[model samples]
Target: MATTVRRAVLTLPAAPLGPENPLPPLAAPGDVHRPAVPRARDGEELPPAMARRMTWAPLRSLLPVRRRDAYGRHRQRTDLDALVVENDRLRATVLPGLGGRVHSLFHKPSGRELLYSNPVFQPAGFALNGAWFSGGIEWNIGATGHTTLSVAPLHAARVPAPDGGEMLRLWEWERLRDLPFQVDLWLPDGSDFLYVGVRVRNPHHHTAPVYWWSNTAVPEAPGSRVLAPATGAFHFGYERALRRVPVPVWDGADRTYPLNGQRPADYFYDLPDGERRWIASLDAHGHGLAQTSTDLLTGRKLFLWGSGPSGRRWQEWLTEPGTGGYAEIQAGLAPTQLEHVPLHPGGEFAWLEAYGPLAADPARVHGEDWAAACAEAAGRLEAALPRATVDAAYAAWRPYADHEPKETLAAGSGWGALEVERGRLELPGTPFAEGTLGEEQRPWRELLRHGVLREEGPEPGPSLVSAPWRELLESAGPGPYTAYHLGVAQWHAGDRSQAVRSWEQALRYGCAWPALRCLGAADRLDGHPERAADRYAAAVAEARHARVAHPTATALAREAVEALLEAGRAEEADALLAGVHPTARSHGRFRLLRARVLLARGDAAAARAVFDEGFDVDDLREGERALEDVWFAVAERLVAGDGPVTEEVRDRARAEHPLPVRYDFRMGA
Candidate 1:
C-alpha cells in the first residue's frame, strides 16, 4: 500500500485537564536533581570546557507555569482528535492536540505495537507546567525538565513529502526559549520504518539555549534488554546525581534489563564520537522496537521504572490496571538530557529519526558481553535501515519542509501567532498566522500596538516574560497593572531586587493580593521566612476580605498556610486554614496543608486521620515524596513510645509501619 495520512477520532477514558492556576509563577520549584560529583566515563576525564557548557543557562524561571491540579480521578470516555500516517509495513498515530505525540506505532507485518500506546488519558503533574500523560513518543523541547507544552497542542498540517506522499507536520513556538520548532512524520512507501524529521529554529538576533529529547515509550517485559552503541553511561537516579557506570552490569546486576533495577533511573549512554546514534529494547524473543537518529540528534538514553513497589505503583498510576509496564528509549541533541545545546542567531538544527521493529538473535542481543550485544544490535540495524538512508531522507525532506500546508489538521495555542505578530517573523515553513491569535494574546497585542497593558478582567490572565515582551512592558506607561506584570517579567529575567521593588510599587497603588503573594515569595527566597509568612497571611486576609473565592484565592490560602506552618506558627496556620472558603478547605492540596498544620500543632492523630480519610492530590508532582514523607512523620509520632523522636525511633517507626501502597510515590529506593 502507498503511504497515507488522514485524520481520525480516538475515544479513550480521560481525566479532564482542568483550568490552570491563576497565579503567575514567579520562581521555579526546587530542582529535583541532587548535585552529584561528576564521575569520569570509561576512566577518561570529561573536558573542563564541556563540563561547564553542560550546566550553562540552566532554567531559573519562565512564563506559563500554569498549575493543572484541579483534575480528579473521575474519567469519562472522550473522543480525541488524532492524525494517522500509514504505510504497507507500519502505521503511526499522532495526537496533534496532545503535544503532537506519536501516540502509536505499529509494525504491520509482525502484528506488534512498536510503542507503548497509552490506554487512558490521565493527566499528571509531570510537565514543567503541569498535566503530562505517559506513553508514545513525546517531543521534549525547551529547558532541562519536560516541556511546558507537554499537554498543549501543536499546529498540525499536511505537507508534501519527498516520496510524493503527505507528511504530518506539527509546529509550535516554544515560549520558554522563544523559538519555533517543527516535527514532520512520514512513512515511505514499502518501508517498515516511520521517519520523523524535527527542526528547531532560532529566529532571534541573539543566541538561545535549546534542548530536544524524543522520548519513545516501549513495552517492558521480563527478560527485556535495552541495547545502545556504548559501553558506559551516565547513570542518574532520583537521588539527584549523574554517576558514570558500566553498561548492562552495574551494582552487581545487568542494569540494562528494566526489571533488574529497583528504582526509577536514567542511563544516558556515553556514545563515542562518530558512532551511529540508536537505542533499542528487545524482549526475550528478540523482537522489539528501535530508534535511530542523525548525528545532529546525538544523545541516546534509557529510562526505567523498576520492579520496586513505588515504581510499580507509578506505572499503574500512569495507566489503567492490567496494562503492561513500559520503558523509555530517548534520543536528544546533547550527550545527556541535563545539557542544552546553543543555537546561534538565525541558526536551525534539523535531524531525521526512524522507528521500526528490529529482530536479532536472542542470545546475542541479551548476551553477557555488553559490547558484543550492542554490536550485534547495531549491525542488524545497519543492515535493516542504514544510517546513510536516514541522512538522505533528511536531505530530501529539507526542501519539502517549506511547503505550505495542504490541509490544517489541528490548532495549537495562539502564543506563536502573537510572537510572530510582535516580531514580524517571516517563517515560511512554519507559519504562525495572525488569525490564530486568541483572548490570551489580546492584552499583549494591545500592549504591542499601543503603549499600555489593559488588564481589564476579574483576574490577570497568562503572563509573557520573553525579552521582547519585557522590553515592551518597560516602555509602556507606569500603572499598578503595568507594575504587577513588569515585576513578573523582571522576576523571570532574574532581576530579583527590581521585581520586588516593582511589586511593592503595585501594592502601594492598592493592587492587593497578587502583589502581596509575590512579595511573600521574594521574602522566602531572600531567607526571611517569618516576613514571608506575614506577607502570605496578609495576602490571604486581603483575598478573604474581598470575598474572592476564585482558584487564585485557593492558591493563596495554600501558599500562606504552608508558609505559616514553615514559620512554626501552627495556631496562625490553623486559623487561616479554617477561615478559608469551604470549597478551598475541601481541596486535596488544602487538605494536605491542614494535615501539616495539625502535625505542627502536635496533633499527629489528626494528621493520620486525614490520610485515612482517603483523599487524592490530583496534581501530585512526579518524583514528589510529600505524601510518603508525611506518612512517615505521622508514623514516627504515633510510634514515639513515650520517648522523644530520635534517629532510632524514626528507624523503628519506618521498620514497624510500612508505607501504604496508595501513598508511596517515592522515586528512589
Candidate 2:
C-alpha cells in the first residue's frame, strides 16, 4: 500500500520559501560568520545576570529588535543545498541550506509522513527573540526554549556511510550559550528506522543550563494520542499554568485527544522512567508512527493545541492545517520540561532516538497492549542506537543511580505530579501560580531578556531586574548592538533625546535602518510627522535589496509603507511596495497596507477587491479567514462614510493580530 522508495542521495534545489516564510531577518544579511559562543573554558563563569536568566522558559514576547548581535540566513535559494536521502522503507529530505533541518520524513510502506512535514518553511511569530518556524525536529540549544540560531544555516555535509548509504550531518556553534551542538541523521539501506544522533557541548569552565528537544511532528486527528510508557504527565498550559495529570486518561476524558475544551494548547512533560524509551502516536485506526531509544535518558513528550477555531488558525498559518494539522511528539533530555539541564564546562551530552512505523488494531490501542507493543518496538531499537551515544548516555545515567525502571511507575506514585514546594510537597499549584515566582525560580526568557530593558518605560513597576544590565548596555562601548540597546534603555528610562542620539550613534556604527526605524518612531511620538517620514524613507531604501530570503526585508518594508502612508505619501507607499518580497505580500499586514493605499488614492473599488482577496494574520492562533472577517467588517462600515474610516479599525486590528498587542504584557511594545 506504500510506494517503494529508492535509496539515493539526490541533491535537490533549495526548498522554496512560502507565505509562512516571510519574517524579515533580525540581523543584516551575510551575518553567518558572526562570532561563535565564547568557548567556555574551565572555571569561567557566566556573568551572574546571564546565569540567572538561563533557566527561563523562553516566551514569544514582542521586544525591540536588537539585531546587531543577531545572525541572519541571507543566501538566496540558489546558494543553498537540499539533499534527499532515501531507502526502500524510508526517505528523508535534509535542507542544509536552512539550518540543516530534516525537511521531511516519509514512511514508504504506508506512503505517509512519520514526521510533521511542514508545507512551508516559513517564519512566523514564535520565539522570545528572533523568528521561528514549525515542523520537523528543530534543534534548540543555548539558553533553552528557542535558540537564536535554530532557524539559521549551519555547517553541514553529506557523508557516505560504510554500507554505501548516506548521512546528512550538521553542526553549529551557539554564541549566546558559548557552546557547540551537532546532529547526524541517517536512513540505513534496508532498515525501516531513521537513526538520529545529537551531541551538545558546554566547552566552558562553569556549569551552564542546557535545554535541547528534537520536536518531531506528526499528523493529529480526533483519536490520535501519543503512546509512551508512562502513567502520569506534567502539562504546561497556554496561560502558563502547570498541571500534573494521569497519562492517557486525565479527569474523565482521554488526554491524548484534542479534547481539553478549556485548554488551547497542551504540553505534556512525560513521566519517562529509566527503562521505557519508545513513544508512538496511534490514529483513530490505531496506526501512525513511533520514535524510540535504547537509553533511559531520552524522555518523551506530547504537545498539541486544541482543535478549536484558534488552534485551527495556527495550523493554516504554519502549514497546511486543513489537510491534517500536525502535533509534536517531542523527546527531551530529562523528565521535566522545565528542569534546567546543566552541562559542566568541557562536558558533552550525546544521545540517539530512532523513528519507525506502527500498525495495530484499534482495540490494542487505548489498552494495556499498546504499551506492550511500544516496549517491544523499543526493544527492537536497542540495536539501532549508535554505540558511542549509547555509551555516553549510560555514563550520564549512572550518576543518578536511584532511578527505577519506568515499568514500575504508577499513576498515583513516584514523582507523579507532586508540585514541589519549599522543600515541601503540595500538588495544588505551581510556584508561578502561587504568586511566588522567586528570582530563584526559572525565569521565562521573554521576561529575562527585556523585562529589565522595558522597566523604565511609560509605566511604573517595582524593578524585577535589580542588576547592572543597564550599565553594561550603556558602558559596553559604541558597538552597533550596544548602542542600539543603550538607546532602548535610555528611551525606556524616559530620556527620548538621548535615545535619539544613541540610535544615531548606532547608525554611524552600521546598525542601519533599525536605528532609523526607532528614530522615526521617536519622531512620530514627538509629533514630527515630516521627520518620521524622512527616516522611514531612508529605511525603505536601505531595505530595497532585501529579497524573500532576507529576514529583515518584510518587517522593514511594512514599517516604511505605513509611515509613508501616514505622511500623506500614498503614491510613494505604493511604489515602495514593489520592493517587498511576494511572500510578505501574502500576509494581512501587507494586504492591509495595499488596501489603505488604494483607499488613499480614492480607488474604493480596488481597495474592496483587495480586501476580499483574503487578508491574513501571520500568527499561528489566527488564520487568513479571521482577517477576512475583520476586513469585511471594516470595509462594509466604510461604504457610507463621508470622512476617513473610524478608529475602530485599529481596535479590530488588535483583535485580529499579534503585532498590535503591546510588546510587553498589558502595556507598551
Candidate 3:
C-alpha cells in the first residue's frame, strides 16, 4: 500500500491596494521583483523549474485538485476579513450624512407618495426649521398636481412702490409641503394681505389667463331669504324679479321676490359706489348666516345669502336700475386676465373677496358682538390656508406636486444599468421628436425659399399662435375654452363618442364657438346629421352676436354654411351665407356651394357657368388643394356620359390651382 503525506496549509490576509497602502502594487514600471520560494521534500530543495512554477502557477498542479480547492477557500476567507477592516477605515474618514436641516415630510393618500426633506441641501433665499406636521387642505395645482395647505396668511404686501403711490396688498398662502405659495390681492385700504381659506385649483406660476370663479357653500334653512342688489340683468338668462303686475320692481314696493313656484338662476353683479347690498337668511330659530363685503375706501357693501335649496337662488337688487350692486363692483376686475398683473418669481396671482357668518338681523346682536364674530371666523379661515417656508420647502413640495415621480431615476444611477437583459429598447436619438419640429422646419424653409415677409422687419403672418386661444384651450381646469378644446382634441384623436360627450357638457354651461363646432362635427359623425346641422347653425348665429371678437369665427361660420349646404338644405344655407361679407377674391368657395345646389336641381348649364366663373376668379392660394378637389368633382360630373368639355369649363381648368381630389356628397358632408 502507498502512503500519502499531507503538509499543513497556511493562509495570508489580503492587504489594501491603494497608493497610501503598503500592499502589493499592480504591475507597473520600476516595481520590485521578489525571488520565489519553493517547497522542499525532507529539507531537499525542489528542482529549479518546479520551484519557479510553484511560485507563479496556480495551486492545482502541486497538490491534489481537491486539496488545492480547500487552500483557495482558506485564502478567500482571509481576504474577506482584510476587506472588512479596510471598509471600516474608509467609513471612519468619510462624511456620514447630508448637510441640510429637515424641514417637513408629507404622505398624500390620493397620490400615495412620500415627501421628505434632505438635510444635505437647502434652496437659496430662505431657511427652514420645523417639525413635519399633517392635517391641511388639499388644493389642485394647475389641474394636474395637488399640494397641501398649512397656514394661509390674511395679509401680504410688497416693499417698494412701482407707481409712486402707496399700494396695499393682500395675499393668501398655501403651505405646499414645505414651500409657501401665495395668492395676492389689492384691497381698498391700500394695505394688502394674503387671501384666506379659498381653494385655487389649476393655478399658474405667473401666467394665468383662464377664467376662474370663486365657489362658496353656505348653510341654509327654511326661513332664509336672499337679498342681492343688482345693476343690470343677471349673467344667467333668468328673470331677476317676477311679479303679478307688469310694473318694474324698480318702482319699489318692497320687491318681495318669491321662489315658491319658480327656479332661481345663479346671479352675478358689480357693486356701485356708496351702495350697500344685503342678503337676509333667517332660520326658524331666528339665527342665520349673512355675508358682507365692504369697499372701505368707497363705502360700498356687497352681500349674498343661502337659499336653502340644493343650489343658491341668486337675486339682483338694484339701488339704481342702471347701476349699484355686487355686479358693478366686481365688474372693475371683469374681463380679468391674470396675465395682466406683474407677479414676482414665486408670487401668486389671485382675486379677492371677503366672506363670513353674520346675524340675519342686525338688531339680534350688538354691533360689537357682530364685529367680534366676523373677526373670529376670518381668523379661522386665515389659519386654514397654505403658507410658504424657506429652502427645504421647495424640495418637499415638488416631489409631491410633479405628475410622475416614480419614473425619474435616483441621482448617480447610470443609464446603462436601467436596461433589461433581453429586450428591445427605443431611445430618443435626437431632440425635436415631437411634431413641433415640423412647425419649426416649415417656416424656416418657407423663409429660405420665398424670402422673409419684410427684408428687415417682422414676418407678415402671425409669428406665434394666439396665446389667448391656446391658453383658453390648453390650461387644465373646467373652463369654457378648456371644455371646448378637450372636445376638439378628442374628436381629432378619433374618440367621437367621448368628443360628443365633452361638447354637450360644454354647451350646458355656456356656448363657445369652438365648442359648438366640435359638437356639430361629433353629432354629424354619430348619425345625427339634423342635430349637427342645427348646432352648426346656432354656432354661426352666436359668433355673429358674440361680444368678444375672435378671428376663427369667420372660418367657423363658413364651415356651418358648408354643413347646411351638404345637408340638402340649400335655402337655409344660402340665407346664412348671405349675411357673410365675402370679398371678391374669396367668394369662389361660397359660390361653388351655390353651383352645387344648382347642379343638384338638374341645372347643368347654370351650375357649370357658376363653377367656371368662381373657379376662375378666386385666389385659391391657401386652400388650393380644396379648390382642385372641387374642380375635379365638377369636371368628372360634366365629362360623364360623353358630354363635351365646354369653353367655360376648359378656361376654368387652365387656372393655376393645386389640390387633391376627394369629394363627399353625403348629407352634411
lDDT of each: 0.86, 0.54, 0.30
After TM-score superposition, what is the CA distance of residue 335 in candidate 3 from its true location, in Å?
53
**Clash tally, candidates in order:** 1, 16, 48
Cα lDDT for residue 228, candidate 2: 74
Could you tell me the lDDT of residue 372 within candidate 1? 84
* Decreasing lDDT order of the candidates: 1, 2, 3
Number of the candidate with higher lDDT, 1 or 2 = 1
Q: Candidate 2 has what TM-score?
A: 0.58
Clashing pairs in model 1, backbone N/Cα/C closer than 3 A: 34-240
Candidate 3 lands at a TM-score of 0.26
Show where candidate 3 strays beyond 4 Å.
1-477, 492-494, 547-550, 584-586, 614-669
How big is the positional error of residue 49 in model 3, measured in Å on the Cα after superposition? 62
Model 3 C-alpha lDDT per residue in residues 139-201, reported as the tens digit of each score:
222110111111111222221112222122212212211112222111112211111222132
